[model samples]
Structure formats: C-alpha cells, structure tokens
Target chain A: MKTLVLVEHGDGKVHDATLATVTAAGKLGSVAALVCGDGEEAAKAAAAAATVAGVDKVLLASGPAYAQMLAENVAALIVPLMDDYDALLCNASSNGKNVAPRVAALLDVMQLSDIISVEGDKTFTRPIYAGNAIATVESSDPKLVITVRGTAFAKAASEGGSAGVENVSGPGDQGLSSFGGCESVKSDRPELTSAKVIVSGGRALKDAETFKEVILPLADKLGAGVGASRAAVDAGYVPNDYQVGQTGKIVAPQVYIAVGISGAIQHLAGMKDSKTIIAINKDEDAPIFQVADIGLVGDLFKIVPELTGKL
Target chain B: MKILVAVKRVIDYNVKPRVKADGTGVDLANVKMSMNPFDEIAVEEAIRLREKGKAAEIVAVSIGPAKAQETLRTALAMGADRAILVETEDEVEPLAVAKILKAIADEEQPGLVLLGKQAISDDSNQTGQMLAALMGRPQGTFANAVEVEGDSVTVKREVDGGLETVKLTLPAVVTTDLRLNEPRYASLPNIMKAKSKPLSAKTPADYGVDTAPRLKTLKVSEPPVRQAGVKVADVDELVAKIKALGIA
Candidate 1:
C-alpha cells in the first residue's frame, strides 16, 4: 500500500498532528508526506516532515499560491498528484476538512472522513451523529481518501527518521481564490489536539472575567491546554477557538479536567475520548458525571484556586 | 444577484441517538426531526443578504426523502423566495448530492451557493466543497462572517488555530459556521404564507445524477462508554487522583 499524508504545519515547523497522521499512514503502508507552503517556511516544514518517524519520503511544493493554504489552490495541487498513491490521508483539521473532499470529488471518488480505526486497507471506523454512534464503513473505490482523527491515534516520534526531501512544482496563484490574511491567537499554551492535558470550562463559569480568573490559573498550573464548552463560547466567555464540542475542536488528552461544565452530550462528544476525565461542578447530578472518570462536585470558584495552589 | 442555499433534514440535535440492537445503524424511527442547525444559519445568512439588497432572489434546495419537504418549508418560512426538493429514498452520498446540486445551480444560474459546513447526521462536511469542485468555482468553508461586493466575496473562516479570511470571486460556494448569525424564528404569519410560496419536487434521475451509496456500512454501534470514577472530597484528593493517573 502507498499512502500520501498531508503535512500540517505552522510557525516554520510541522504540527504534531502530522506526526499522528504519519503514524496512521504507517499502519496502511509505506508513508510519504507532502508539504505545501511557500519559500523558506515551506522548506522548514519539509525538513521537519522528513524527520517524522517512519516517513520514508517527503514531497515539497512551494510557491506564493500555497502560502495561504487555500482549499482551491491546495486541492488543485493534490488532484494531479493522486495518480501514484493508493490512499491520501491528512489530519481532520480545518485545512484537511476544507481540501480533501474537493480532491476526492475531482478524482471522482468518495472519501471516508474522520476515521478512528483501521478495520482493513479498505474498511475504516468513524463516528456519526455527533459521535453518538461509531460506523464501520468500507470504500469500494480504487483510491481511498481519508481524514484521520488525530485524537484517536498516538503520534509518531517527532525527530527520528531521515527521509529524503523532493521538490515539486506548485500551480502558482490560482486567481479563483486569494488569502486575505489570518488571525490566530498568540499563545504559549499547547495546541488543543496534541496537548497532553487540557482544562476546559463551561457556561457555569458565568462570564468572561470569571472564566479567565478561574480556569486559566488552573490550566497554567498544570501546563495544560485550555478548552471551553459551547455554552461558554456562545455566552461570549471565550472565542470560538476555546470551544470543545461537536461543533468545535475534539481533543483526547491524557487528563481532561472539565470545570463548571454541565457535560452536555455535545460537549462530551469532543472530549469523551480522553483517557482520564475529571469534572468540577457544584451540581452533583450534572450530566457530565456520566462520562467523567473523576467527579468533584463543588463551587469552581473555591475549588479551582485551591487546586491550582495545591498543585 | 441570486443566492442558492442547501438545507438538510437531520435528527434534532438534542436527541441522544440510540444504536439499533442489530448494529445496522442508529434508530431513526419516530424521532423528532429538524433542519440541520448549520443549514439554518445558511438560510439566515441568505435572508440577511436579500434584506441588505445584495441578493434579489433566494432559492433553497434539499436532497432527501419526502419528509425533506418540511425542511424546505422551514426555509421558505425563513424568507426564501422558493425551494426545490430532489426527492430520493436511496441514500444520496455527498458526491452524488453535489452532482445534483451542480445541476440545480446550472439551471438556476445563481451567483452564490450556500451550504451548512456539515450535516449533523453524517457530518461528512463534503457536499459544498464537492459541488465547488464539480462547478469549477472557488469555495470558502467554515465561514463566520461574509461580505459581498461587485464581482467578489470576502469570508472570514473559523479554522483550527483561529480565524482566517479569504477572498473568492463572485459565483462562489460558501459554507456556514455556527457563529455566522443567529437564525431567526419562522413567525406564525410567515408559516402561513410559506404554504402559498412555490415549492417544486424533482428526482435525482431528472438531473441525471445517481443517488447511490458508494461506501458500504459494515456495522454501526454505540461509542465506547467511559465509566465514572469515584468522586473526591476536596482539591487534595482530586490532585492525588490526577497524580495517580501518572500525569505530571
């Protein structure tokens, strides 16, 4: 089996999500990574991808067109490269979800999205109905297009392989789309998908100020990524980036501590995959307890600070 | 400019789906149904655009069983000028649905196509992008905000890291995200008027698109349950439990 994994990167480095996809691809067959970017940063990303454990080869496509990582331009670049590979895989991040379907359509095939397990070379397991059900789906098409749920797979080593890098051409600046700009929250906290531990809050935090004063200190003490329930985000306590639910980011950290969260099923869909779950809520009967491994029923205001101080 | 919006019928988001005992699929018998939430956002965006005079006509389209007409009526009550239903009982996967939408777009000649980033049921998140590919047009997915002007549209999209903005030329495909706007309620008067508005029924065969499932489902089961651990008395015990998990 031949697998081509899309390399997701930022800040001149390969995101750990790529390592997870690379690991998933290794299960399928010989692994090759494709890094699409522009100029120097693209080279940096390619070099980083070349070192992912078990990545046998890295293909680099650099130009102004790829700088924005627009789906239109990126899909254009990948559709032409599908002639050689049996399967194309990428992390189910925003970029992957944005581009892979278009590639599948242009290739006249169907895509098996967000697969969690490899049932076989042609069959995979995925979540449906906001992750309420798991479906084992098999693709009959000649080529398989899949987006791996990074949280479901363990990441490969970041710096162990010595794959050779190959330069490829990019279809320069397709006038169909253009990158206007991007605004990512500048933070020292780890990215949500790859973080080892996460401290997430819910609407029970009440408002923005209370959320910051209560959740961040606890998160910082543990050096964990910060997440929030959809209620918190919808209530304007945090930006969309912080929301963890079916509609937002899905994280499977080693320890997920949910604060003041009622544990709506939608919120559980995002983090129930975490290995160990801890809940902090004033109400003992909150639905979050159904899935939480450890329950702490009390006021978060008093409990969080005490936990942060004790830690 | 004309706006074309695609909506879908899915289980109400509030319902906890029960997997069938036979493991064929989730049980959908006698469950409450509603329009996919993100598609409601799409229809809302289209109505706001028409209200702003950026669009002259709004057409809602859906591809599903006869029950989908109720979803189309919901769109009509939300201010769509008309709706078209591509009726089919056979499973219409994303690729086939995109083909049918492409045919509809071709016939309607709308300047814009709007779809929910994904349906709550299958959650494939593929139809809009596939339609864009088949139509050879630009696409903006997971859009939080959108602005239209002469010959171009600017969309601010929600991504993994944060928000990113992209500019697409007119006659483009855009998918709605949750934060786009709160969908307005269908007023009692609007519901009455929606019955008078034009609604057309067609089939996938009429558009020469095959509504066949390309992927086979081998099994469907409930997600593995995470058993609840013992509750702790205080922060000290909580920290001890976390530490016992071998997490630093």
Candidate 2:
C-alpha cells in the first residue's frame, strides 16, 4: 500500500508537523509527500528531505489557489489524489483537521482523527474524551484517511537523503467557496504544534488583559506557544483558539509550563504528553501538579515575572 | 433560506466522566446528559439567522435513542421551528451520521447546514465537514460567526493562531465554536410551546441510510490516573522546591 502525506507550509517554510507526518508515513508504506504551494525551492527541498525517509517521490502543485491557507480549497486539490494512493495521512493540526474530513467525505471513506497509533490496515488507537481515555477502533472502509496526533509520533530520519521532485497538477475549479477574510495574529515563536516549550495560562489570571501582560511575554522569552486552560477560555480570558483540553488542541511540547491554572481532567487530556511539565499555581493541591515534573505553589502574579526574568 | 442543525445527546460537560469499572465503556449509568455543547451553538446560530430574517426555516435533527427526543425538544424550546428524530438504538459513527444527514439534506434541501464543531461525547469533530464533503459543497469548520447574504455565506473560523474568514456559496456546511454565541435557555413559555411543536420521527431506513457501524470499536480504556500532589508552606518554599527539581 502506498501512502500520500499532505505537506503544509506558510510563506516558504514547510510546517514541522508535515515532517512528523512524513516520519509516520514511513512506518506504514512507500510514502509520497505532496507539497501544494507557489514556491519551487521549498517544494524541492521538502521533496528531497522526504525522500530520504524512504519516500518514492515528491509531487508539487503550485498555484495562487494554494496561497490562501484555506482547508476547503486544499481539500478540493487533494481529493483527486486519493485515487492514486491507498491511504492518506496528515498532521492533526487545525489545517489537517479541516481538510482531512472533507477529503474523506469526498472519497466516501471513513477517517480517524487525533490518532495516536495505527496497528494495521484497519485497527487504530486514538484518544477520546479529551485524553482521559484511549479507544481502539477498526475502520470498516478500505480506504483510510487519518490525521496523526503530531506529538505522539517520532520524526523520520532526514540524514543524507533526497527524493525525486516532480510538478503535478492538482484538481482545481472546485467551484470553490470563498471565505469572507482572514484576521492574522503576529507570532514570533514557532507554531503551537512545533514549539518545544509551551506556557499555558488558567482562569486565575483574572482576565485577558492580564494574560497578555503576565503570560505572553514569558512564552515569547522562552520561544514557546501560549496555551489556555478550558476555564480560562470559558471565563473569556482568551479566545477558544488558545484552549488546550480534551475538546481543544492536544500538544506535547518538550517543556510545558502551567501558570495559574487549576488543571481539570479535560485540560490535562491535551497536554499530558509533554516531556517535562512545570506547574505554577497558588493552590498546592491543583490537579495540574499531579502530572507536573516540577510543581511551584505560589501566586502567578509574583512568580511569573521572576521566571520570565530568569528565562 | 431554510437551515438544518443536527444535535447529539451526550454526557454533560461539567461532570467528570468515568469509565465503567467493568471496562465496558464510559459509566453512563444514571449519568446526566445534555445537548452536545457545540450543537447547542449550531441550534442557536440557526435560530438567530431565522430571527434576523436570513433564514425561513430552522429544523433541528438528532440521531439516537428515544430519550434523545428531549434534546430535540430543547432545541425546539430554544427556537427551532420543528425537530426530526432519526431514531437509532446503537452507537453510530460520525460517517454514518453524515450519510443520514446527507439524505435529509437532499430531501429538505436546506440552503445551509450547520452543526457543532465537535460533540463532547465522541469528540470526533467530523460530522459537519464530512457532511459537507458528502454533499459535495464548500464547508467552514470551527466557525465563530456566520453571516448570510443572498446566495453566499461568510464564516469566521477559529484557527490555531487566530481567525480566518471565508465566504462560501449557498448550500454549504458550517460548524459552530464555543464563542459562536451564548446559547439562550428555554424559557418556561417556550418549554411549554416546545411540547406543541411538531417533532417527526424517522428511521435510518426512511432516509435510505444504513445506521450500521462503519467503524468497529475494539476497546475503551481509562486514562492513567493522575498522581497525588504535594503541598508546600509558602511561595519561597515552593520556588525552592521547584528549582530543586530543575523545573522553574
């Protein structure tokens, strides 16, 4: 069975999660990386790097239609490619979450999302109930389209390898629906899924204004993505985009810092995979510390500044 | 334009769910159930669109056991014009549910289809996008806001970093996010009115859709229990302890 992995990129650089997906595809079958963008150099580089991991070749589809970072349009480009491959895989990032299902729907295939393990052709293991439970499911359909939880899988070896790069035309003129517009947020740190360090806030921070001043700078200083607990999001301290929980985004950063957050079960489901967890909460009994590698019992108001200054 | 919103009955979000001691599945025995939060948002958005004169009809649909009629009633009380209960006894995967919705969409011919981004129970986050795909139409997932004009719909979607707005042509699918709108409670009068609202029951067969499992569930296991926590006397002591562990 041949596997097709979708490569996501912005500006010109490929998303690290795509690299992770390539690594995962290696475990399944002969992998082919699909780079859809307007940059030839990046696509060539991506194809070359992916080939080293035993990928047969890299297919590039460059066009202005690929520029908007819209998943609906991207799915239109990918659905046609499904016929040539046995399985389709992508990183379970926001983009993948949006596009993968559409592809599955188009193919009339069943898909598994936020998947952690793939045992064979039909059986897969995934986290359900936010990370509180792991369920093993068997796909009844022959064609499987799945999104791999980026943090659960290991990145493929990129040492001294290159693959053949070929330009291919993806299906366009999907009579695509246009989006109203995009509101962009500036970030200096790496994307949330790729970040090595994460600084997460909880509702204890009082409000959004406080999170911006007290938590964001620390994440910036550490080059980490900012995360928010479910409570913080429910309290309106931050947008739901920043939520990390069973219902929100799952992350496994190298170092996860929980600030002023009382860890709830749903919140813990998303971040339990972090290599090292540091919990800073005034409540010593906060559930977050139960999973923390190191725990600090203190007011975030007093401790965050000290920690950021040190970082 | 007429819109159809699908909802699911799941374990209440506020309650901490526990796996059965027998390892059969989540301990649903005597558990409190509520409308999947996202679907509530979907229902709310549909009702708001109709109230604003953007939509002519707002129909709420649910697929589950007979008890799920309560969920549909809640939607009716909240403002749905009527309800469709696609009654089923067994658990249906998201794909199968989408197939059923596609059948309904074909018959009802709603210009717009809306659903909650993910149901809290399964957390699959698939139904809306999959339904859109099955219908061969454009889709917007994780939408925080939706506005309709003429034959096009503009959706504001929540992305990883921030938000993106997309304009989709009519006969599209859109999913709701937490911030889409604060769902209004069913007032006493509306609750009474919901009893009088038309709720039609249909079997999966009626929609020409099979409710059989497209995915087999092998097993469900509880998450590893969190270890107990330690208490420190003060902030200075906590800082000292954290630093000793090389975490702070």
Candidate 3:
C-alpha cells in the first residue's frame, strides 16, 4: 500500500517538518508527497524537491484558493485523493491538525494525532496529559489518517532520489468555510518546535507588564520563542498561548531557559525534550532544576536583569 | 437560530492526572470530575450568542455516564437552555462522539454548533471538525473568536504564527480556543436554578449510533522522571557551568 503524505508549504517554500513526516511515512510503504497550493509551478517544484525514499510520485493540486492555506479548501482538495492511498500522513502542524480531522471524517476513518512513534500500521505512541505521560494506542479501524508529531521522527533523506510530479484538480464548491485575513506576530526566532533555543518565563516575572523587559530582551538576544509556565499564565502574568506544560504546548528546543519558574511535572514534560536546559529560580529545590543542565539559585528579579544586561 | 454546544466531563484541569496502574486509562477513582475547560469556553460562547439575540435556542449535550449530568447542569447554569446526556460508561472516541453529535444535529437542526477543540482527557481535538464533515457543514476549528453576521459567520482561528480570520455560511461547527473568552462561573442563584433545568438522558442505541470503541489503549506509562540537579552558587558560577557545557 502506498502512503499519501500531505506536504505543506508557505510563501513558496515547504515547511521542513514535512520532511520529518515523510520519514515517518517511509516506515509504512512507498510514499507519495502531495503539495496542494495555488501555483502549479511552485507546488510541482516542491514535490520534485521532496526526494523521500521510496516515493512513487509527487502530486500537485494548484489553484488560487490554495495560495493561502485554508483548512476547508485544503481538506476539499485532499479528500478526493484519499482513494488513491492506503494511509494518510501529515506533520502534526497547526495546519495539519486542522485539516487532517476533516479529511478523516470525510472518509469515515479514524485519525491518530500528535503521534510520537509508529510501530506498525495499527499501533502508535503519543503523549498524553500534555507531555507528562505516554500512551500507546492501537486503531483497529481500517482507514487511517495521522498527524505525525514533527519532532518525533528524524528528517527523511532528501537526496539520492526524485519523483515525477502530477498536477491534479477536482470539482470543489470552495464554499466550505470563510477565509479571514491572518494577523501574525512576526518574530525573528525560529518556530517553537524547531527552534534551537527557547527562553521561557514563569510567574516570577510578577506580571505581563515586566515580561517585555525581562524575557523578550533575553529571548531576542538568544533568538528564541518566548514560553511561559502554566503558573505564570494562571496568575495572569502572560497570555495562555504562551503557557508550556502537559496541558499546554510541548517543545524541544536545543537550549531551553526557564526563568523564575518552579518546574512542575506538567511544565517539565513540555520542555524535557530540549537538548540543554537552564533554569533560574529562587527556590534551590524547584523541580525545574531536576531536568536543567544549569540551575541558578537566585531571585529572578535580580538574575534576569543581570542576564539581560550581559546579553 | 438554534445552536448546540457539545461538552465533555473530564477530570478537573487543575488536578494532576495519574494513569491507572493497569494502563487502561487515567485513574479517576477519587479525582473530582468537572467539565473540560475548553468546553466551558464553548458554553460561554453559546450563551453569548443567545444573549445577543443571535440564537433562538441553545442546547448543550455531554456524552458520558449519568454523572455527566453534572457537567450539563454546569452548562445550563452558564445559560444553555437545555441539556442532553448520552449515557456511555466507556470512554467514547472522538469520531464516535462526533457520530453521536451528528445524530443529534440531524434531530435538532441547529444553525450553529460549538464545542471545545478537544477534551483535555483524550486531547483528540477532532470532534468539532469530524462532526462538521459528518453533517456536511463547514467547520471553523480552533476558533478564538466567532462573530455571526446575518447568514455568514466570521471566525478567527488561532494559527501557529498568528490569527487568521475566515467567514463561513451558517450551520457551521466552531471549536473554542483558550483566548475565545473568559468563561464566567455559575452564580449561586444560577447553580440553584440549574438543578431545575431540563435534562434529557438517552442511550446511544436510541440514536442508532454505536458508542463502541475504535481505538484500543494498549498501554499507559508515566513519563520519565526528571532527576534533581544542584543549584549553582551564583550567576558567575552558572555562566561558568553553562560555558563548560558549551551550550550558550
């Protein structure tokens, strides 16, 4: 059976995570990387470039609506191709998560999401309770759609082979959902999951008023995305979107810096994947130190300012 | 416009969940059960729709045991007009739950359906989109804000980099995100009145939807334990250690 891997891209470039999903799909069978976008030329180029091992073909579905990623439009485009493949895979990205379920529902199949490891066609492992626990779930259902966690799999080999590209389009009403303009907070730092460095703050910052002063400057210096512990968000020190924990987003930056945060199990689960962890907390025995490669015992109020000044 | 909000009864978000020893699932023998936090956002949005004169009626449904009525009542206390409890003792997978919801949608003919992006327990985050597909309606998943204007609904989705706004026709499914709204707590008076709210209980068989499991939990294991590390004496020591590690 051939696996259909949905390759997502933006601004004429494919996301690197798609390569990771391609690697995971390799375990199943021959792979077909599908790039659906507005410009056939761009899509075809991306498909040709995705030289995943054992890839049979690169399918490109190009249209004006595909220019900007809309879950409904994307789902409509991919649903028709579901019949051509046995298993569907995509990176567990925000876009992938949004569209994969709709596609699964259309085919009346089961979808496994945020999967970390796939042992076989029916068996997979994923994190639960945020990242505090791991569960292995087996799907007995025949049809399957999966969103592979980007960090879970290594990047697939992009050299040594290429696939023929095909341009395909089908009937679509394009009336699934409305497309509203996107408001993005532009940052120079890498995406949280793929970033080599991450700077996180906790309730020790006192409030959001001082976050810009403490975390942002240091994060900017380090070129890292800003993260928050649940305690910080619960205390209204920062927005919930920034919270990192078992209930929040999980990340594995190369370097993770936790400032003024007592590491809770939930928080630790989210960041433990980082290659090197550094924590700054007043409490010497804070749970964060357990996982931290470097632990500083001092008031964040003092340490952060000093660190930022040095940076 | 009639609107339905799907709720799930789960362990309180504040509770540090523990997996059962047998790895069947989360241990819930003594843990206090409450409505999922994101579902609370859905409940609040539905109530706002009703208060704004957008929804003619609002019905909140939960799929779980009879005890889930408590969560439904919480929704009622928050302003849902009625409640439905689809009694299922076992944990219903997202797709199956969506199937049950689609059945209810066919019966209710609601113009809009709202639910949390995912139940905290399973973290599937699939039901809203699945239900939308099953019902042949448009879906706006992970919506941070929804504004209904005449026959069209404007939804603000929480994308990875930022927010994206989309407009969809009526009779769509929308899922709530963290910033959707601050869910208001049920007042004492409303809590008292919620006990009087109309609650209808039915079996999945009644709706001709199978609540059977599609996914099996082969094992549940605790996350690896983090070992304790010593605190460096000062910033200079920390810098020295970090320099020694060659990370920064």
Kept native contacts, fraction for each prediction: 0.85, 0.58, 0.67
Which is the better candidate, 1 or 3, if ranked by TM-score? 1
lDDT of 3 by residue, A1-311 (tens): 67898887766555668878888888888888888767655664565545655567888777777766677787888888888788899877667878899899888787898899988878999887766568899988777799988777887766656788787885544776656688876666677767777889888788888877888888886677888887787677765557676546678877889998888766876788777888998888787887887788888878877776665
* Regions more than 4 Å wrong, model 3: A44-49, A52-55, A158-160, A207-209, A230-243, A246-248, A264-266, A284-286, A309-311
For model 1 the local lDDT of residue A307 reads: 87
In angstroms, give how far residue B23 of model 3 lies from its true place. Answer: 2.5
Instruction: Flag regions of model 2 displaced more than 4 Å.
Output: A39-52, A234-236, A309-311, B229-248
Residues A146-251 of candidate 2: C-alpha lDDT, one tens digit per residue: 8988788877655445677777776654665764566766767666677788899998899989989999888877777888997898788877778887767788
Listed for every candidate in order, the interface RMSD values in angstroms are 1.0, 2.6, 2.1
Report the candidate with higher lDDT, 1 versus 3: 1
DockQ score for candidate 3: 0.64
Off by over 4 Å in 1: none
Per-residue lDDT value at B221 in model 2: 87
Alpha carbon lDDT of each predicted model = 0.92, 0.82, 0.82
TM-score, every prediction: 0.98, 0.94, 0.94
DockQ of every candidate structure: 0.84, 0.59, 0.64
- Who wins the DockQ comparison? 1
Preferred candidate (DockQ higher): 1 or 2: 1
Worst 10 residues of 1 chain B by lDDT: B239-248
Clashes of each: 1, 7, 4
Least accurate 10 contiguous residues by lDDT in model 3 chain A: A44-53
